[model samples]
Target: MAATELKAQARTGVGKGAARALRREGLIPAVIYGDKKPPLPVSISYNEALKRIYAGGFLSHVITLDVDGEKHKVIPRDYQLDPVKDKPLHVDFLRVGAGARINVQVAVHFVGEDKSPGIKRGGVLNIVHHTLELSCPADAIPEQVTVDLAGLDIGDPIHLDAVQLPTGVQLHGHEIDPTVATIVAPSGMRAEEAEAGAAESAAPAGETKE
Candidate 1:
């Protein structure tokens, strides 16, 4: 629940040219908007931004961004990346109030995987949803949703309801409970099953006296 402290420079100009100029200076333009307040333009280091973005759960992590002296508590709302080079172009942050609730996508982390019976039997663990969208308190958004895989069998399915979330976090996949993950038979197991089925089908219908 602790917020990360990040220092950023307040931007004076706002335009394509100004953004391009900041990029050339190793800074990426960003905006802080939301919570019924005016937008504040700022810029952060490109390398720092890229490092944090690739570090995992960038959007879900709360940040106490210091813009030239003023500080704002915010969460990343969206970002733009260069398609070709895959570099960060811009980032937008939503101002977070003490009691504000924000919808965020949280990464899924499975524990007890090594202890799963299915995994030990050479079954493949197929993940259906790597990240789950959740409505959580702005200051209490979970970094990741953990699912327990203990004692799971090859044919066992992991439903969304099985996932354990934080205290105040809310999940809205109500109409149809979705499967988060499942353990499936490996290719070798699948092939053996197929061959066994074929052999049974190929058995002669006519009885032969021995």
Candidate 2:
């Protein structure tokens, strides 16, 4: 994962008016909290922040925030967007400590679909969960998890336990392992059934009419 560097200034004012004023000045209002520290209000360049956010995977990527010359390692935790224009309004950053384990949702990527027996047999792939919540070391967070569909057959369900996490990473909670995906009969099967029913209904009916 590439680290993105962002520059910000510490803000003294708070609340709606201050936020609006900051936005009017082409800045974004933000806050950094966590690691037992006080919540720090800050402001950053709107264009720069949007560029990083649009760069993709901003939430999962570790960011290096330069707040008034002091560097902080953080990750974007939450953000609010304008409902009408869909522009970013506020952002919340979570400070990460060295070796600290943080819970984050990691995107799951499916691979080896061409090798799956189910797919070869015209089985449809049904995804149950697109992401998995994981607890990982701050410095070792994985960008995404890969789930292989090789050797999978129709009616085979992939479970959470089948995924392999990197070293220093683990499932976030003790909840029961859930199904990630499964293969089932394709939609064409339903159409085929309907066609079969229609064929049976049409057969030999003409003789009775005569």
lDDT of 1 by residue, 1-210 (tens): 679988899999899999999999999999999888999999999998999999978888899999988999998888899999989999999899879888888888889989999999999989999988888988788768889999999999999878777899988545356799999999999999999999999998988899
lDDT at position 11, candidate 1: 91
Poorest lDDT segment (10 consecutive residues) of candidate 1: 169-178
Q: Candidate 2, residues 117-171: lDDT per residue as tens digits?
A: 9999899899998888888887888989999999999899999889887988888
Determine the backbone clash count of candidate 1.
0
Q: Estimated TM-score per prediction?
A: 0.91, 0.87
Candidate 1: pairs in clash: none
* RMSD of every prediction: 2.3, 4.8
Lowest-lDDT window of 10 residues in candidate 2?
A: 201-210
lDDT of 1 at 172: 55
Task: Give the Å error, residue 96, model 2.
Answer: 0.8
Candidate 2 residue spans exceeding 4 A from truth: 190-210
Cα lDDT of candidate 1 equals: 0.90
